[model samples]
Target: MSAVPLATPTVPRKRRSEAELKAIVDDFNATLAADPEHEPTADEVAAWAAFHFDGTLAVACSMADAVLPHVVSRFAPGVDVLFLETGYHFSDTIVTRDIVAEDLPITLVNVMPELTVAEQDEKFGPRLYERDPALCCQMRKVEPLARTLPLYEAWVTGVRRDEGPTRADTPLVTWDAKNGLVKINPLAAWSFDELLAYAGEHRVEVNSLLSDGYPSIGCEPCTRRVEPGEDPRAGRWAGFAKTECGLHT
Candidate 1:
């Protein structure tokens, strides 16, 4: 079992007002607008955010891999790493989450939706993901994350541009107006190979399913193993028109 944080570590710096936060995003973007190609390295970006947001920064991780958390934690030790506990993950994923929480300098936040799997089934009927994946995702993933994101002034995501067309334009930093926070994607420029290399170099705990061909891991029932030459994200929400779970969209 994951050794979850009893309580989130206190951020010495108070969260800035939304207006102030938005200005910071604007300033950062404007500074980098002149040379997108000359953007700072991932570690440099993480350091900038760590200094600016401090305790108000949250990292969203799916436990598919711990590379993002490992990278971010170097700059902000004991940062809160939010994991949506939808109660539908594979055993391997749960194990990986457990190991990561114990091994890394991070606080594990097991964010849960209002409804448990049983409650969701009792309320909305079983296998709702088959009937309506969007609603299932909204309840199990999106809504829960939306409710939790407001506590922070900024967030870090593991999104990479090489994942697929849907994420081809992922930016390193942007004002996530939808979540009302400054969104940071430090791994935006990394490829799958680069991610694996980092994990190997740092000895980060990775979900076993990743090597089992499930590159883009999501809920167990909704995810599949990708065939060769297929896009990494093709395994997620297979047979459906959904490319995203509505968190980034």
Candidate 2:
């Protein structure tokens, strides 16, 4: 057979201005206000967003076990769910990822850091997470996310007011200055108990590790089990003088 042409990758175009973004939010809010119980269908939301934004929407799957069903059940299939695969996750975390991906009706897009573990170690030296967390995070999390952010109009997150200080004021909708795209926090006001209740009510699959003192899970080397009365995310990047992996920060 003759050689077939490979398809060219499509780079996302520039995003709308702040004024345009504000208008879109205003319109969305109006729609929600007019019919609180009659929320726009996920397909409808995705379609509406496509007209305005030009970047890939992402969600940290850390606690998504509680919300993935609602997002999948409501949104269109093939709606991208970008998972940052930072190459340092625990085995259980990977297993959980497999379980979630197997069941969800989303187009799971696994985003990875540009370098491999060995390569990263070679370049930056081993255990760089202990030495320079912010730089390490920039290499592993921020840069990878920035690479893909321009592919969708908005990104969704599972952040909640209960997560703690940094995320306490996370708006239901806001502009992410760093990524320059609309960020949607559908579960902003949801309490941890509320999330648990929803998961129980829906029989959603959760990370097995969650029951084992790991309220927040991330790369294996950085994460640990939290103590009682500690923040749920305390286990993540523990003792590294860091909290968020730059998704929210």
Candidate 3:
């Protein structure tokens, strides 16, 4: 009897084809669309995502002022929250980062540009943002995000449809073919007013810059206080041809 040992059984691995994955997203979207009266909670959405893509995905919370709380609550503590720490951010933005770290259940992953600020300055001179905005963004924003994205199976963003043309087509769940990962925008349908209302109702701490007319905060060299009639994101990368940090684009 000792001559033959029992063979171990192997569990079959599940491999989802592109169409199957798309079907999952599409079905979820259809569910949400059909149940328009019943707004899905953050927990519900997170649970569904976790169930479908368990052990194969990571949540990338952006920690933006509007959707940070929702993302934090949806994903458990120590989940990766990616921040593009461009080193050119304002002191206030840094303060906000610390505040978020203390208050939320998040593991902050600071994604920095390959080039040091000093190195960049030496190569392109100080205030390179003033000269070539696209190149500056490429070094500061795009490159860092591109480097960090490959480390995860999925990423979560704080984009909302009301943010305007740039984010209007944001889906609740979609494939990022370029990055080869799933991109989830849980709060895609929420408006700025709705976001603020949720924050107020939940007692979420927001960045101080928001109160000072800096609606969309970014690198210190490019951000400014927007006028009353201007768009919320107008303050970021002002006077530059850049609208987004290349994350959405």
Candidate 4:
């Protein structure tokens, strides 16, 4: 039999302890509480995150657009942008991500689940999303992000207050106890009109689905088209009781 290859050793990166991180979170939350209505500019938010978590900061993008990555890169060039490769994305979403990676100044890191799609199907049975979207999302999106987020002290997200009722009260900066990291929502106060204007001004790449009646895009199987008057997020998880895939909450 052929000799088994030796396992590659990994040098652990220095990370803040739970106590230290909790202290920082408490301080930051105090500051946020004092000025609860303070809405910092996107650039200012980026600067604050970079100042505190310079070497251990990351941005999580849903691949719906490159707007957040574009804004963060202004302050932290070459920073890591994590994309959850759930193996169920639309073709346009993947293309948008690839284009952003090729054209932008940031490093695109494709975070993936432990099992491949076929393996998951074999283990959990086919059409897992149809039968149990929450479980599928837990294995594909939530668990993968949980595994990857430990490497960073802070992360930026693209959530906006205008998205829907569920995200209406999104904070600019908050501690994510579930993932044990500081979460930053720089565009928490931005409107859809503002987002579009910024994208036009910056010439940022957006997924084609946005123009096809899908203002909020997710995994293809659960997404559908929405009417003009409906909520932007209504297209996601259509006819289901699921509002989110458990990434934010």
Candidate 5:
């Protein structure tokens, strides 16, 4: 089958007021709550995002898979995809990112931290993630994203409820109080198997680590392999008490 042409986005930059954003969030959350069992089709999810955020919609891809960007490109081609390049990813992660950028119609924006790994190590001592994973994540992931998130009114993520207990209540759409912006998780109801199935069905690019037992890929130093029956995220910060990289928490 021939690939569909990406639609050209014509919506101008339209930043909403605080009250307007709040109203949208409230209404959207209520709608989801009313139909808790309802899982919107990818096309429907893309349509809703286009209707609400329009040109300001950005997809947050972990480079674990290109599923989210593939869905977004149908409605908003050339949309910004926020990729946090924490300077600690595996070679496969970077390769996956490049593959997605080349294959997808979206724009890949590499969000970087204020300091390099060398600078950070020099300032905070070596291997911060080992000593304080939360603070390391704050410096590399959370802080950088928080700075760049203001450019877009709404951001979409690949987070799923089945990933872990902390993410069990993942919503399709909600107000991100931490970043003070509208957050969208279209695949919140999807399971790990569903994600892989979608990728296979759509021929989306997936990280190589997934087949190697790293269900949830993060930085090389912080991420490890998970054994059978372990939570998908168990490999992340394995020894530490940190389940999340603070991007979602």
Candidate 6:
């Protein structure tokens, strides 16, 4: 999240009652999880979410790769893809995001934090990520996302099961208690190889850092290149026990 220009404010959309949304999630969970042996493909899940949520859906992309947005936009063209502009991203990440917005059949929503990088530095002192990554992420990533997510009834994420232990049991569909909306992880079953394969097959624009050893790209300051045989997300928040940025948990 480098210092950038102001983001276009997203107009909050009318959301359905929480009860109705929760019931929908319950129904989807039951229907999709009915079969023990068979699981739905990412495309199948995306299609289901597309039809069910329709215009009231959003896809959250870290710009690690454009595969998630590419997969979902096939079913729901012009869907809003929310990119958290924390003003601390790697240059490659930003480049990938811009390319995805131009190439994909979706609307790009630049979700910015309430304060700019300078303002945050002034108030919280410089290099807060080094002092307390959790609080930094809360103000930069989680809060901004939480603020923008309500404009949609449901939100789709690219969280894969193999990312690490924290997301090992991620479900395909569930009620997002934290965000108060339907949460869909279409690629929950996908492996790193599967992800790259899809990106290559579809000719999607991927962040250059992926091939350069930064398996899990995050804010420049908190991220580093991971060694071979390390956890895919080992590069993120390197020195702390912080596994998540307070988004999924």
| RMSD to the hidden true structure, all candidates | 1.8, 5.3, 8.9, 5.0, 4.3, 2.9
Better of 2 and 6 by TM-score: 6
Sort the candidates on TM-score, descending order: 1, 6, 5, 4, 3, 2
Best-first order by lDDT: 1, 6, 5, 4, 3, 2
lDDT of 4: 0.84
What's the lDDT for all of these models? 0.89, 0.67, 0.68, 0.84, 0.85, 0.88
Looking at model 5, residue 81 earns an lDDT score of 81
Q: For candidate 5, lDDT tens digit of each residue in 35-141? A: 97876766787778878887888888889889999988878888888788899999999899888888888878888888999999999999998899889899999
Regions of candidate 1 where Cα sits further than 4 Å from its true position: 1-9
Q: Pick the candidate with the highest TM-score.
A: 1
Residue 59 of model 6 has an lDDT of: 88
Candidate 5 vs. true structure, TM-score: 0.92
TM-score, every prediction: 0.95, 0.80, 0.82, 0.91, 0.92, 0.94
Model 3 per-residue lDDT tens digits across residues 1-249: 011111111111354566776677788878979988986765666667656765344444444472554454454444555667787877776676667667776555567788888999999999888998789889977777777665555567777777757888877778888776677777787787777787788777667777788767778888899898887788877776667877777
Query: What is the overall TM-score of model 6 with all chains considered together?
Result: 0.94
Clashing pairs in 1: none
Worst ten-residue run, lDDT, model 2? 1-10
Name the TM-score of candidate 3.
0.82
Off by over 4 Å in 5: 1-14, 33-37
**Residue 42 lDDT, candidate 3, scale 0-100:** 58
> Model 6 misses residue 248 by how many Å?
0.9
Among these predictions, the greatest lDDT belongs to: 1
Off by over 4 Å in 2: 1-18, 29-60, 63-66
lDDT per residue as tens, model 4, 124-242:
99989999999999999999889888878888999999999999999888888899888999999999888888999999998998888888999999899989899998888887888
Candidates 2 and 4: which is better by lDDT? 4
